[model samples]
Target: MDIENMRAFITVAEHQSISHAAKELHQLQSNMTAKIKKIESEFNKELFYRKPRGMELNEEGKKLYAQFKKIVLLWEETRSMMNEDSPVLRLGLMVSKNPPNFDDAMKALYETYENLMVTIKTGSTPKIEEELVNGTIDIGFLVGKTDMNSLHYKKYGTEKLVLVGKNIDKPLEEILKHDNLIISSENCYYKKILDVLLEDHKAIRSDFVEIAALESMMNMCQLGMGVTLIPESDTARLGIRHYKVIDHSCCEIEKFISYRKNHKITGVEQQLMNRIVTAN
Candidate 1:
């Protein structure tokens, strides 16, 4: 079967509409329909149940979809290995104060392999997990452990969670009661820990601020606009002294490095992973 046909089958199965899949693939609806028909003809089986609403995959179609996805991924990986002189390592990272030391790792990788190329995508843990399963990234650095069976996880390091504010002299209860809660994002793991700490203290903040940039959040906290919870490494790096170490039950969080379980680890990729694991 053609690799393009396999990709088209996966897209149609995901969208359940040839028109939608065609638009996504920048192809005509007729072309998409013909590709599906060709696949079904080759298999001598009706893969889809044509409903008025949309095309739904049959049992055989579901099986083929799974296999085709793997085949497409393998084809891409093989092509990448054959076509490029330099090896490329795609990485996904969760936004955090103290992420893995990829800067040093990449520096070492580039020094060892002159033609090594590295790409990084940063987002929430869930986003990173999704991209990893989709085979967009080879490795992921994220907060906490993941229960994804398709991926394998390793303990990268641990971070000491701390609350940073201008008024470190004040009591925790007073700070929680009066100060605004400044967080990076709604899905941030540190924000969840802060939520639990607040519940434990039964303290309600006056307001909350969501800032995407770490520097901005820290500046806001320095100006007494709000208080934010971050890794103690961040405060030390920035030379911020007006912060208190969180003594709550969730004071520390583990960082993890994840990758797809079935992914074939290349020599360069393995070297980078070794450097990261050793450094951490």
Candidate 2:
């Protein structure tokens, strides 16, 4: 079936006026009328009964309209979703509070391929991970290790997790008595570490406050909103001093590029992934 002709029929059916449909579609009145006739001739059926005030669906028209409406809507939705899957590769990045080296990796990936659309979404681990799992994002650079079986990851490197706060803080024990720990949402990997700390120390869950991203959390911490646990790289960038955990339980974590393992990799997506891995 001619999708365009059906589209015109559907619109005319909806508006009940060829003139109205033409106006809405930015088409000429005669053009709209001709398209409707084209559909009718093809089906050997007249879809609409013309009247002075407007048009109404005939019996044959009503049945065909019901069937075609579902098909057209589905086609439109499919097209819309496919629009997100343009031949251009889509990439999602989860940059820490610090400068990310993944930009270099992207530059490397695009150097050899003209068909690439790199989209960077910078946020805390939880936000980025959600995008990767939901398939909203094609690729992601996340902080910390993940156990998701469907997704595979290659740990590029580790960034030291430092204790960040304003002035003082000779040792962690002196501060652990405090009531709050500012961190990312629960979905975040780093936040998981904090949860462990809170559990071990018997810290109140009510004292935890999750921020949107590293920058916001760090800024809030800087303004004395609350103390935050962040990567050592963030400490320098936020212009704040940091200290190491005294207990020797390592706070450093591995960063990784993660994607669905079972997903059928398109040729272009595969090539792009290869380029990303090679560049990294």
Candidate 3:
């Protein structure tokens, strides 16, 4: 039996609705309906009784669902246990949270797969997207709008952006008139928001500096060089002053884990994905 079709059968049976099952599986309703139909044709049996409410499994479907559940469990266990040196998982990270918080997930991964190699690169969203398309990276974490139809993404969390400064004794209005701004590279999404905010405030700067690294940006702000926008969670321990944006729409960013839609997900990849999605 086709494993995907069997899996689809199980999902539909559990949900008792093809539309719900299709949404959960990230597949179109028509595609999911076709898969179920194909499975029924293969077995030469009607697995579900069509109804106005939804699909209800017939006797044969109940029997096959029970067996398929065990089969899926066994296959997952086997795949998890098959340990060997796997290809490198090239990951791209865009945000910087100090005291690196992914230790537990990394430890769990190493324990589960002893020989798999992992590499991490940090860059802007556009830069990482280019790398992903060129096969230089396998997966990436991005913040902001993701409109690439050729890629797949799961939104895991949200980060709040705030204007952070060091030892500023002046009001926000006075600070806006300083004409000095610190931010990331030109391609950064945060930088774009900062530009819009500056324009709205009529505080166009002739002294805006582009610092590529998050640590460096914070350091520059600490030295009273200029104010910068940073993720709110990252400013807790830095003893910095952060202000909520006057326009609240640009302050919240949706965090996503993105990968190529056509790439096959392996057991290891799925485990790592689960850990990341859960941890965040």
Top model by TM-score, which number? 3
Report how far off residue 18 is in candidate 2 (Å). Answer: 70
Candidate 2's TM-score: 0.55
Off by over 4 Å in 3: 1-26, 30-80, 83-87, 95-101, 167-173, 237-247
1-280, model 1: which lDDT tens digit per residue?
Answer: 9998997998788778898888656699999999999999999999999999899999999999879866765665456456658888898877754355668767766765567677788887878898999998998888875579898776657888888878767888877777888887887777778778888889765356889998898888898888888777777687887678867768888877788888876656655654565466
Residue ranges of candidate 1 with Cα displaced over 4 Å: 1-84, 96-100, 204-207
Model 2, C-alpha of 207: deviation from truth (Å):
1.9
lDDT of 3 by residue, 189-260 (tens): 787777677677777655668887777877878777888777777766666645544446777888877888
Q: How far does residue 115 in candidate 1 sit from its true spot (Å)?
A: 2.6
TM-scores vs. true structure, each candidate: 0.66, 0.55, 0.69
After superposition of all CA atoms, the RMSD between model 3 and the true structure is 7.4
lDDT for 8 (candidate 3) = 89
Candidate 2 residue lDDT tens string, 42-121: 88988788898999999999888777766665564345345535445555655454236445645654564455565566
lDDT of each: 0.78, 0.65, 0.73
